[model samples]
Target chain A: MKQDSCQVTVIDRKRIELARKQMPGAEVLENVSEVLKLLGDTTRLRILLALATTELCVCDLAALLEMTSSAISHQLRLLRARGIVKYRKEGKIVYYSLDDPQVQSLIKVSMDQIG
Target chain B: MKQDSCQVTVIDRKRIELARKQMPGAEVLENVSEVLKLLGDTTRLRILLALATTELCVCDLAALLEMTSSAISHQLRLLRARGIVKYRKEGKIVYYSLDDPQVQSLIKVSMDQIG
Candidate 1:
């Protein structure tokens, strides 16, 4: 028999069972993975990090990043759809901000990890 | 003239300038995005989550996930390369665990956001 990298000489049944039970269901894992994928983009991550500090209008984000307003809007639309960001209209100018504490926490924790 | 979705009727130069200053450099942003991308995968994320709770050898993880040892080892190699996970050899068995507190924080915040 070919030696497998994961050779099971001593199986810790107790630990394995505990980890299996702790694992989230498939649906939740899929949902969380999708959110992480959305955030995996540099443009979107920058947008969220910028928004975490302060709210800005679409054009403001474009200006801040030196990117086109249209480009910024496209990413913002995706972020909004996922509830990672929220926007409100103030007399025709729409201001976008982090949707909730959860979004802020995500940004903070991820940044801490990379920094 | 076509109106852009991010039409700038009133420019907030101060906020825009502040946000620009606050934005991380390209290298840092790239690094963070890469980390997020790695965790974005369901298998890798699950593996990390499991290791977060208890240390497990490669075969242990394979059994817990009901996946082949080769698949689990593949993901572990990637995670190990990124410093997201660490492993130690005990005789012929290698045990894997989370590398740092940063990884734990990343998992917790992300789960909180999704939950």
Candidate 2:
């Protein structure tokens, strides 16, 4: 029984080591978690989904979302900090769009799969 | 000036409507947010990442993660509720594995893009 248990322990250890190796980033997992967390909010996810299709300014997003510009701005800040969205200013308007194509692809694929 | 302002308002309303139409699930968005929120934690994300590679029992995951089995069990419960992971009981052990192929694919794509 002791010998059998030792062998099982060794196998478990090996399996874990293999999992760690395949995962690659113990460091970036937090960043990934944060990004996923940001997407976890329905409003934020909808905002990202909208932005993925085209660039839009705060006022437009607010009008479309039926939300205040302040709410839209706050969500955009979170998305921007994670490098998920990018924006450019023109006069008094700031236009926001997805910074990474992967993000857009992710949103598209997830939405399709879910539907 | 009134005519010009009306044109701008119409354009803004049109843009908002377009955003709403493109994103189909105002209903399921909440569920998606919940799933994403569940995946938002580093430990849970790691647990999912580890499970993505192979089927692992709670004890093995705890050992590998250097966390308590209780903690691993809690995380697994969330993942299971989200339908992200599935398990089967055999004798005294319950083996857990990724339930959805799309989930595995998403993880692979995201990891690759990040790296």
Model 1 per-residue lDDT tens digits across residues B5-73? 444333787886678788888988888888888888999989988997899998888877777878999
Docking tier of model 1: it is acceptable
Q: Which pairs of residues clash in candidate 2, taking residues 3 or more apart in a chain or in different chains?
A: none
The TM-scores, one per candidate, come to 0.81, 0.84
**Candidate 1: DockQ?**
0.46
| Model 2 bad stretches (over 4 Å) | A1-11, B1-11
lDDT by residue (A6-113, candidate 1, tens digit) is 454337888887888889999999988888888889999989888877899987788777678789999998989988899999997899999867667777778777
Model 2: lDDT equals 0.75
Report the TM-score measured on chain A for model 1. 0.79
Error of 2 at B10 (Å): 8.1
Chain B TM (all candidates): 0.80, 0.80
Q: Ten consecutive residues with minimal summed lDDT in candidate 2 chain B?
A: B1-10
